[model samples]
Target: MFFVYKILIINILYYWHNDCFTCIGNINLYHMRTIKLLFTTLTLAVLATACYTEVIIEDEYIDEPVLNVHALLKSHELWYVDINATSGNREVPFLQRAFTVSFVGETVFANNNIVGIGKTGNGFGLDVGYFNTANGRLQINHDVDGYWSLEVFMVDNNTIELYDSNSRTSYYLEGYQRNNFDYDMVFYDNIEYLLQEYDVWEKVTTSKEGLLNDFDSENYLQFYIEGNRSMFNSSVDPSGMHLDDVLWDYSGEYSVFGVYNDETLKTLTLDYDFMGNDYFELYVINDSTIELYHSSSGTVYKFKGKGFISYLKSGISQLDKKRTKTEYGTMKVVRKRKI
Candidate 1:
């Protein structure tokens, strides 16, 4: 259009100049200059309009469909709270401890325990509170934690950000369904809680080839969290005895060390107050069983998890709660010893 206008203006000036010279015989220099100036101004105006119209067309934007925050909250069966990805100086205690949270109607559910994590509430855990969504915000009325209001920001189709204004913190959550979620990762990541899930681990099998040791007499084991310490109890009581009826022979602190590069393997050290520390390589046979290889004795003992203890009704133990607040990567790592 600019090119067309320039061509048209040139033709008009050519014809006008010819006509003025022919009709006036000798046109004044001032009149000729004035006519040229008027034509130049008109051409510039047309070019400016063309440029302005192009910019308007380029700047035009297509409207995106606004996300329905309420619907999104209920879309996924579970929202795994990515604690490590959280931002801000202050932490929200409930969110910090929760492995996963879910929204169903007006109720909010959270999987705070790693034990039976994939199976509890069909992977949604327990109903901790009630929640309402409005104006892209989530207001939660927790049964134990009280009330909280957070601005909901959708990060993606499967991710969301819950930003707390009062704390100036943002928590990132990833959405997943029960069937597709990686429950094994959760178990390995929080294996400490898994050990505490059972009332007792009864010795079911023992390899005969290993050398005799003090652990050979032990038939039952229990791991528990008290205050800020990870503690354990061992008993020589019969395997079929009830948890409360069994006599615990030794009680002491314990620590689980992660393998350097292996996620499936771990080392456990039971600090026996009288006999000294006993070290074993630990392996999970299934959700309800674990195998411990005593490095010193060369014995492989398999323990079956008995009497499941869910943390849902009574709330999580202090040690488990403290572990949740800390970074998982900071766990102690030990190099696997070659047999």
Candidate 2:
């Protein structure tokens, strides 16, 4: 049936072309113009048949394995630096603040400008940031728990100072000192003693959960204690005398409690009134005790240790409050670490 149709169409074209050509010689102006139009149409049809396009469609959504790229500070280290067009010239690579990225394992992220050292699995990872760049010389010391923690500072082009957290000691290195390879590897006997003492503290606090439950109903004096010693505490006085006093209040996505005094990085406790309004107390304390050795009072107020759940809940509330304060407006733009 298809062949027969093709044959019929061909016969019609042949007759039409023949009629048009014969009429062109003896016809009037109108008839000659019609023949020309027919001839042009047939020529176009023949040309169209010879030129056809073959199209191939591909499925772009097919799943396949792919390797991802990350900003690598060192071979084993990766840090997150958010790139926005407005950062700078849009050409130079900016040393970004450090953050950890967990690709296969944990990676330390530090403010690339600061010398950083942290405890690695069995050894330590250290990087020095200088040279108009960051993490210029990435080095590691080998020893089981060899260099558990690090702090770095640049003394000069060839010299950098480092402090180890595990050892709690500092060392200086000349630019060309020991081929930059050999570490003076000092073993502090005192570190061993401190570790043993710390172990005793750990054993006593191992049953923290049971201790918290035991004080389920006890009235605290505005402190949270890990043992007889308070790890965190707050104030109860409304006159804003305590560190945990109503310095600020917030709620929403986060709740916040903050205390500021003349001292920088001073320690203080935040107390919460679990019975009254959801307000918290802020009080100053010594190392691990809610007791404040005030020059005026010269007496220690036995602060109470609230339960872990309430303390954490109050902390969360404080986070929300902080967020609100940030939204309102920031008085100072102090840089801090975040994860």
- Maximum-lDDT candidate: 1
* CA error at residue 282 for candidate 1, angstroms: 1.5
* Candidate 2 lDDT tens digits, 204-315: 1111122222122222232122322222222222331333333322111112223233112222222333422222121223212222222122222333222222111233
Error of 1 at 112 (Å): 2.8
What's the TM-score of every candidate structure?
A: 0.69, 0.26
| Model 2, residue 191: C-alpha shift (Å) | 20
The deviation in Å at residue 279 for candidate 1 is 1.8
Residue 250, model 1, lDDT:
97
Clashing residue pairs in candidate 1 are: none
Candidate 1 ranges with C-alpha deviation above 4 Å: 1-67, 86-93, 167-169, 315-323, 326-339
lDDT of 1 by residue, 1-339 (tens): 878887887898788777776667676799779877987798889878877643434667899987688998988888998877889988777798788999987989888777667777877888889988866679999887789999988899999999999999999999998889998877777788778878899999999868999898899999987877889999998778977899999999998877766777878889998889998888877889888898777789999988876544654542245334433333355534344
TM-score, candidate 2, is 0.26
Q: Candidate 2: which stretches are off by over 4 Å?
A: 1-26, 54-258, 261-292, 298-339
